[model samples]
Target: MTTQTYLVSGMSCGHCETAVRSELGAVPGVQQVEVSAATGRLTVTTDGSVDDATVIAAVDEAGYQAQRG
Candidate 1:
């Protein structure tokens, strides 16, 4: 497994957090996600094949921006 952290912007509430989480969760390799809007961070655990672009795209679809840490 691989663990990655990302900084996300534009998340402001619980609904936003859930949206982002759900989006990421739908990805095939994603196993866990922790989002902290107050700190603008997201931590993800997934299988090694998943790349940062895939995670970022998921965040974008959920209405936010993300970059790998």
Candidate 2:
């Protein structure tokens, strides 16, 4: 398993976490998504190589911006 963490911006509430989680959870190979809106952090666990760009794009689709940390 591989785990990646990203610093997300513009998340301010539980809805933000839910939106981000939903989008990331749909990505191929993504096994889990953990997000904290208050901290603006997103952590994803995957079973294999999932491109960072893909993850970032998923976050964007959720209406936010993120960069791998």
Candidate 3:
């Protein structure tokens, strides 16, 4: 398994966290997702290697911006 942490922007509430989490969780190979709006942190656990671009796209689809941390 692989765990990656990302810094996300424009997350200010629980709804933001949920949106980010839902999107990240949908990525292929993602096993788990944890997002914190208060801290602007997103943690993703995957079964194997997952591309950074894939995660960034997921965050974009969720209406936020993110980068690998």
In terms of lDDT, which candidate is strongest?
2
Q: After superposition, how far is residue 53 of candidate 3 from its true place, in Å?
A: 0.4
Question: Model 3: which residue pairs collide?
Answer: none
Q: For model 3, how does the per-residue alpha-carbon lDDT over 1-69 read when each residue is reduced to its tens digit? A: 988999999999999999998888877899999899988989999987788899999999999999988
> For residues 1-49, what per-residue lDDT tens digits would candidate 1 score against the true structure?
9999999999998898999999999999999999988888999999877
Model 1 spans with C-alpha error above 4 angstroms? none
Over 4 Å off, model 3: none
Better of 1 and 2 by lDDT: 2
**Local distance difference test, per candidate?**
0.94, 0.95, 0.91
- Answer with 1 or 3, whichever has the higher lDDT: 1
What residue pairs clash in candidate 2, if any at all? Answer: none
TM-score of each: 0.96, 0.96, 0.94
Clashes of each: 0, 0, 0
> What does each candidate score in C-alpha RMSD?
0.6, 0.6, 0.8
Ranking by TM-score: 2, 1, 3
Specify the highest-TM-score model's number: 2
